[model samples]
Target chain A: MTLAEYKYADTIHRCFRCGYCKFPVNWMDVNNCPAYARFRMETYSCGGRLWLTKAWLSNEIDWSEHLAQILYSCTACKNCEEKCPLRFNVDIFNMIQAARAEMVERGLVPAAVKEFLENVQRHGNPYGNAREGRGEWSQETGIEQYQGQDYLYYVGCVGSYDTRAQQTARTLGKVLLRSGVSFGVLGSEENCDGNEVNALGEETLFEMLAEENVRKFKDLGVTNIVTLSPHSYNAFKNDYAKYDGSFPVLHYTQLLRDLITDGKLDVSGGMNARVTYHDPCFLGRWNGEYDAPRQVLSAIPGIELVEMEKNRESTLCCGGGGGNFYTDFLGGSENSPARIRVREAATTGASVLAVACPNCMTMLEDAVKAEGLEDKLVVKDVSEIVGEVCGIG
Target chain B: MDIIACIKRIPDTSEADTIKIDPSQMSIEKGSLVFKINDWDEYALETAVQLKERTGGSLIAVTVGPKEWDDVLRRALAMGADRAIRVDQDMVAADCHSVAIVLAALTRSLPYDLVLCGAQSEDFGCGQLGVMVAEMLGVPHAALVVGLQEEEGKVRVDRELEAGILESYTIELPALLTIQTGINRPRYISLGGIKRAMKKELQVMSPGELGLTAEMLAPQVKLERLEFPPRGKEAVLIPGTPEESAEHLASILQSAGIF
Candidate 1:
């Protein structure tokens, strides 16, 4: 490709294909890049994609569904960016997303991806359910719609749509009320955070969603937004600001951590369980929120908090990011990263694999069942743990 | 060359869980739902765009709906349609015949070398409007057209049939063709593209503007109450290893007497 055509052509050249992006910090294993780890192919890695992208842009290769799938397979977990020693690590993920944006402009995306985007376009959420149902879960959950409340509970698409994740959303609401935290939910008024939309390469649609949400938040006078999905938290906390949306955002785990630290809620520690926290890629690596979830988990009196070898920044992805949950690119295969993550979590000897993001909760839960480890290990959201400990669930 | 593409706005039922019968039981409750260009209509719009690109024609998109349907027409404009038209109305349940009458009236007024329409509307699936419009206009018609090619004075089409069969036919120019799905990959319109197309010609006309009274456009058929199908057998979630699941599925197939 011409140097001027690609946005980060210079930085992309700086990659020099060192291959460090395919390993963890410990380098004990090589399956660090989730797509590469799953595919066992060089073409799926960050550097390989970069080379392919250059060739395709330069007209050396024609675009194919295979190339698009490889590009779309990335979860944008940032593991490759994290492990890369190059100074242009930040450009790596953005470059992949940029390439996807180009592919979207050309209408060369996967069929599932097309359906995913068309749904997100029609419905406010990616699930394609009516917007009315988005607010239906807040009923009977003691969560009121925001009317100048202290914080707006911005339940992202998964929590608002998926039945299993709805429990986590409700639990978060209950936990907040029990701790006497002042919060109100946007309910149906809350739009998709457009984080995954941005990652999926619908830049224009993402901009529309982000702008509309920001305008609505500004109109509501919302100062803080607590999200049940790390996907939304990442977008609200970081990406929104780029569009002139400056609002404080916290993953539910961060707020739970704060509540426990303030001693506002009483935990009898009545029930005991062995649990390990699954650091969501968006929460931990994308935003560097390693301690908040862990600190809250540690404070629970009846819990034995353990760690998997691949935890925190070096954590394996749930293979649900970048709209992969709806795309099913990672499922139906043993090499699915979520299955790999659950199998690793099983090694920690913990019965419950706790997660902070709704996307992660769904991914790992299915992965547990797919790997036939559901009987041995269960997946639960971090809020579920707090709900259990506080006798709220 | 001139081409006219008929489109419709329909509530997305991709996720059927949220769809419900309205209080009147005649139509779906679309107040909280999202509406989009009908799926087959999207393919039709793409087909018209592709034909215009290759044959150097002015493509005009037309829809029969209320004011909110302008979004679909705007999208059509962004997809390279030279202009858009909306037959404004206030019908909650439009029948295929009524819509065909309106579309045929609109088609008669325009200078069109060819007419294209979706095989069926998503919500109704009547599969009648295109052929009915063609009959009213007294033009040759091709339905379920999976492929099309322009000739000197005619258009050749591959009509889809049941069981993956295809029937080829060549219809004369100035005829109507109802496009099937996968005729082409529809282009994605950026928000910027739509914003730019907002400046394009988008004409809105009521039935009165077409010299048609409310009675002339009234639906010939009235919809009865809609209800869900009766549940017969309960569905069981078959969860286990792949081999076990396969064995379970084979038994299920056998119970249905397929083997």
Candidate 2:
């Protein structure tokens, strides 16, 4: 909207609008693009959207209601960007969403995205609970008296508040205890990392969150951030720089892997379940962290690690990206595709479903439960698995 | 000790092209997925190699994927996995639960003192298999292991607990463990390791080889849809200088009763 803003958008101008970013032409099967899959329209594809951006810039297409809908229709999955010949980044889709969100704030936002944003701001979470006890998992563990010193584990909003993901937090704590790494947690005062706000293009609220967190980190002398959620990691890794706050950022998987390799942690006995891993979009695609968690799985004796058909770079969206976890959409069920992903992992004949990010854990766990596969498939975090195996009871 | 590290091949997440979605016609675009080591598992492999050097163990790497994953397995070998295994089949059923079943079965067929994995894979985020495998094998397992020491006929581990809390556990040998980052500095596979891994054995398996079946892998879960979360509007930036910003922040917090 401003000259400076135009300069920022210029970096994205090099996109050739080629659709190759989402899929290769030689794909023998499997039609990609969830949006295109749903709508059967080029406007929903990354190429079409990129062209729309170009059109807006060239004044060929006015920024109108139609344009706003086209922008909002994107899930910000960034999958389309992969197939583009020029590798045009699809984060622009998110940027467009953010820009439109700004207009929506001025009573210009289409009637569509209004309720979802309101819920997040009011609830301090997307799930619509004003007094959502985010740190309830820590309470359930009954490990209330342990005063740890080496690290301060920050379970993002999803991990702490989301009931499904809380199991991961508790499991992580238990695993860390078994491994003997002194760590602490903020029983309270851990607010949202402003990730959803920031990603929603609400830079102002995001900054408020950044400043507040900087204050909290400094107040607590927080030297390191151990997060279980990649969404939190992305916010910490990329957005924290905006506030000039730098700390050692490690996904819980990365840190735990290091401990296991250093002769600081040990495993005893073996397991009899075939297992596969699913990569979270933020941890894998948003950030290039692809090794630590699997390495941990592979380190165990007698266990086999398997890959999914859509894995790592080619992973399917669990319908939770860009705060989709909180919104209501009439499209296909959010839990079905991710459940299908879980089934893909299940198809490997592995008994356990492994994951890293809390959001993914929450979504997939629900999918598993919804599909009534709880008895056949057990959902566990890498930390919980390791904790149980460390022989600490 | 010969250490077999189980790894996985996955899509590259940071690059935009790697993610896929089922289209209207149920067609997946080709090459949209770029394969790599499962993000967390790569860290596990690096950790295993490092531990092998320090504690004296041979690192064997393994993964279950179509034969296309041989390159990634080879890359793991290049990264210092002494040996690699590939479950080369259409692993559509390789969800957290089914994969665990297969892995548990395969591990029973081999001999190992320890096992390691990333706390969770980046995609699924289930974070379960490590413990579930331990449960299935009846092995004592630990996650978030930041420290470990093998002593006289026993293993001692310092786990990274939540809230910065820690507790120590000691276990007997022949156990499974999933790793967390920051436990140790994972070493990059030197060119020598890569070349050396080339000489190592890389084996493959099918569901039948692992005694697995689709009936046993009935997906207990399903994702109904994938869509962007709703958004209301842009944040109202109450801009000011730092001091003014603080004052304004205080007012907002006060108004919201946060302070």
Candidate 3:
């Protein structure tokens, strides 16, 4: 993939380096770029990375490990796409990713990314766990095995592998079961939906994974999918169609909201908690799903849904996108986006930081511990909260 | 220059919990384990690829394993190797000496200006295969090579020594080097590149095809038992509310005089 291949060869330099792409949607915070916010360097921002990509493509600069590290650090949080004043952000972000795809082709990717891709390639998930255990979370929980269920419960990698995230997966399953919704899981037969793979710039691998998953789904007569992670939802909804995969996909929150609105599910049991929801990057910024989780939260009795200063579209990333949860590329720093977002959540005085995605739950939970706010601020998945009210988990 | 890279596939033992001794008490369970190309072999293959790129030549990657191990060779081909060969063997518990002998016989039959191998395997870590192969092939060998260059029918290599020391040697052509980690960052194997490499020929032959018998290839070593190292100390996970757990931890730390 060349700079020309991203389809931005001619229009790349139209920016004049205004740097508005580094700001949040409100423009009140100019350092919304996660990489730029961490490194505080222009070289790590959207405009600077675009310029570097242009230079490398034109043979003005050689590829180096430092350059790859800088390029890999962008979490693809989509703030740049939201705030770029010139409206050419699609090309700008694609240009950076195209550079990454080229690097992946040339074997010039960072070691962490290489490891992450290799793990996903071999074990069907990023943690490199045995494929047999991929469905272990559904063990004894009585989740159906995709036998003509109304919806296919597509649990993403984190939900299946990470022990902490598995709790949320089971909670979601229990809540859905209690609601009497018909859903079946793929279990060990599941493969990654390739969201992080694509975001990490392994486009070729991502496509192969997506096509394989789509073929499996089609073979099993799957049409409606409800994903446990927003990452999986984003991949199935946005990228899979390029490979002719058009299964109607819904994030779990959307399904829950619908279930609540239709009066099919009850949440009248009053449970009190001052909880603030962190919008996952893929669910909110990527797909523009700003209200599903909030509506679900608002419907719950005895739940005080507080809003952070940065909410909905302007929400800060959890630094878990782009395979950062496995790579930890932006970790070991106070300024890492997840740590920063935890601090922001603290400002709202919310006792619990509720998350809809497993990736966000795992990332923000760790951030809570790293920030030493675990006692004051506990992280809970939205499904966990629902499961509690349903008297299941 | 023509190069031959010897690679291996081993269980990814990065996670300690994934390892379990088999019922035989001599091997790890294989049913639920994940396998990958040895970490060190990546640097070895990358070294061969880099050398081939600098000077126009064909790179051949060889591994001594079963048909399933051909994926590692395919990975090598994707990383810019010209050819891949797998010696058909399924000796999961085979000693390093048997693999070295088989590799030596295979390398003797291939066209090669230089031979490369990883310094050690993640599972075995014997660090003896390359030297044994060199001894059997009667070629000069360098171990723990972190740097390499080809200069006029000879190869110069930097052998990493203990305590951050480097011993450089310029060995003649037709030599072997066991590459150390950080030799050079290995290239990513793209799915597209691998798909393209899938069309390339992956030659497979048995030890008998290489003029060796099962008796001659028999392992000279045997393992009697395997056991995990005993735990030194265990932290008690207090199961309770956050406040109760914090209090328990605080009491433990206070009694230990750490607070």
Instruction: Give model 2's TM-score versus the native structure.
Output: 0.54
**Ranking of all candidate structures by their DockQ, best first:** 3, 1, 2
Strongest candidate by DockQ: 3
Docking class of 2: incorrect
| Clash pairs, model 1 backbone | none
DockQ of each: 0.50, 0.01, 0.58
Kindly list the per-residue Cα lDDT of model 1 for residues A36-137, writing each as its tens digit: 888988898888888888878777788898998899999999988888877888778899898888887766688888778877787778777877778887
**lDDT per residue (tens digit) for residues A1-393 in model 3:** 555655678877676778887777677776688888777888888778888888888778899988888888888788888887676766666767777888888888888998889888888888878787889999999888997788999998999999999999998998898889999999999998899889878888898898899999898899799999999999999989998899999999999999999987898885799999999989998999999999998898899999988888788888888888888878889988889999999989999899998888888888898899988898998888888888877
TM-score of 1: 0.91
CA lDDT for candidate 1? 0.87
Clashing pairs in 3: A107-B188
- Candidate 2 ranges beyond 4 A from true positions: A1-17, A24-34, A37-40, A53-75, A87-101, A104-116, A140-148, A328-331, A334-336, A369-376, A391-393, B1-259
Count of steric clashes across candidates, in order: 0, 199, 1
lDDT tens string, model 2, A196-309?
666565555567678888778777777777887888888888889779788778889998889889977786465656778887777777787778888888888866888777
